[model samples]
Target: MRWWLTAAVFWTLLIMAVCWLPMPMFPIGTGGEHPKRFPHLDKAVHAGIFVVFGLLWLRVIPGPRRFLVVVAAGAALAAITECGQNLPIIGRDGELADGLFDVLGVFLAYPLATFLFRRVRDKQPVVSMTRA
Candidate 1:
């Protein structure tokens, strides 16, 4: 796999880890000090993270199968990570809204990735001494 692909996978895993961090140790107890419920911020963070990973995956996939592969990968990863929250170690809440946000993140990432890849590919190659 290309370096970018590796980076993308690494980033996806990293984000999953971060998302699961504040769950078990910081469980929202029944009190006045509940965790801040900023749904919009949560959505934005999810969308932004996946958008970057999606673009990078799209870059690495190459050829016509790029978009489909990237999107499917994003969705699969999202599902796996969400389900993994049920594990004893992580103990994160598995909410449908979170999964929905994950899907949206992948969906929003695809087009931007495609456009960036296309733009870069369209650029003219620079002649160098090694090519002569």
Candidate 2:
């Protein structure tokens, strides 16, 4: 559906803001230390969004090869966001671990999305622009 692509773009833009914006712009405080129970909450958050990101792209693209496209796109996004954060003026620290989590999230998302698609969809599907 058109909504999926819209959601994907919106999510990407949201990630851009969240990753690239200045630190103080955060209303909920930076990613240092907050929830004492989980020290790695930040990494979880990174992975979580990427799972959503991967799933959304899987929805947007059609045909058998979408898995490859979604994975490549997700990894590219992870790297881009990491590099964006690395920009000195952005006031954010870039971590390889965070990017790894992001890619891992994408990997984690693909099979789940594929399974759900098989369960819910039939022969004909409404997919993204490319039929291939």
Best by TM-score, which number?
2
Model 2, 1-132: lDDT tens digits are 999999999998898888888777866677755768879988988999999999898899999899898889888988998988878788788889999999999888888897887878775667799767
Query: How many pairs of residues in model 2 come into backbone collision?
Result: 0
Candidate 2 positional error at 2, Å: 1.2
For candidate 1, the per-residue lDDT at 7 reads 91
Question: lDDT of each structure?
Answer: 0.71, 0.87
> Model 2, which residues run further than 4 Å from truth?
122-132
Which ranges in model 1 have alpha carbons more than 4 Å from their true place? Answer: 22-39, 122-132
